[model samples]
Target chain A: MPYNVDAVFQIAGIGIIVAMIHTILKQMGKEDWAHWVTLIGFIIVLFMVAMLIRDLFQTIKNVFLFHS
Target chain B: MIQVVGLGVVATILILLVKEQKPMFAFLLATFVGIVIFLTVIGKITEILKVLAHLANQAKVNQFFLETILKIIGIAYIAEFGAQVTRDAGQGTIAAKIELAGKILIMVMAIPIIITIIETIINILP
Candidate 1:
């Protein structure tokens, strides 16, 4: 919960960076590279986000006691 | 919030630059960025879902209803995501089919809830 904002920043920053690289690659007529860049960026961000989701669910579990 | 906004603006600019030259890649880029943003906030979404689950439990709501609601939401999300992605890829027909599938799935999910509600009402009529 506390690091929620931090996670947002991290993921968004990655997204923007990926977007930038993607733009550059496209402008250079390297569509394939651009696509892979987007895919890789997505996977990296997804991994981090998956951790964040887990953390969030844990917090919710504590609050709601959904364990039982 | 600033970070999210900045990322959004940058992604928008990038998308604009890339769209015409490489429209297909641009769509994937957009989808990727969108998913990134969604992922960043997924924590909050889960929290809300858990809260709903808690409320359902406290109110002694039927498990069947809970499962059905979850499944319906899943179908809606999948359909919406698929349709949007296809539309972004310039495939309107595919998007339409995805939407139709989602609607059918929702109708199927609703049947049990409808029947249960009807049964509950009938029981109260006596």
Candidate 2:
């Protein structure tokens, strides 16, 4: 996984946005929907991260056994 | 690398500021920051693995040993990740179980290497 400062910032930005949305939703008396939003945001960020992590694992496995 | 840590600190501050009435938000922020830190380090892992692979091949080490090491590392990472996520999700007990499973998997993976080393030493003595 290539560590780009930009990507880190992007994730942080997403967090900020999620927090804002969560707060707004809760205040509007939609707690159930707020929690769902939080969960979806978490999943989305993780999915983006999982993509890079997958590459790292592949590289490790190939390097260890195939020298590629 | 430095930037990632800096971001984590910033996120920590933000979490602290928001956590009292926004516990869920705080948890999500911390988790995201953690993932960013993890991704930053992953950038370095590829080069390290490449070097290790070159040396292992040159030294003619057992491929199985490499496989075992890789598997153990995988278990450790997954278990730790699972445990951390559970903790963040406010389920500390599940984290403990995940960590326990990781440790057991690592031990199981190491047994063959330990036995091989012992056998090699005995052969050398006789």
Candidate 1 residue pairs in clash (backbone atoms < 3 Å): none
lDDT of each: 0.68, 0.71
Score residue A24 of candidate 1 by CA lDDT: 93
Model 2, C-alpha of B53: deviation from truth (Å): 1.2
DockQ of each candidate's interface versus the true one?
Answer: 0.10, 0.25
lDDT of 2 by residue, A1-68 (tens): 33554654565566677778889999999999999988887787677666756654564454433433
* Candidate 1 chain A weakest lDDT stretch, 10 residues: A59-68
Q: What lDDT tens digits, residue by residue, belong to model 1 across residues B59-97? A: 999876876777676567667867987788789999999
Weakest 10 consecutive residues of candidate 1 chain B by summed lDDT: B20-29
As a whole number from 0 to 100, the lDDT of residue B116 in candidate 2 is 98
Backbone-clash count (model 2): 0
Worst 10 residues of 2 chain B by lDDT: B20-29
Each model's Cα RMSD: 6.7, 4.1
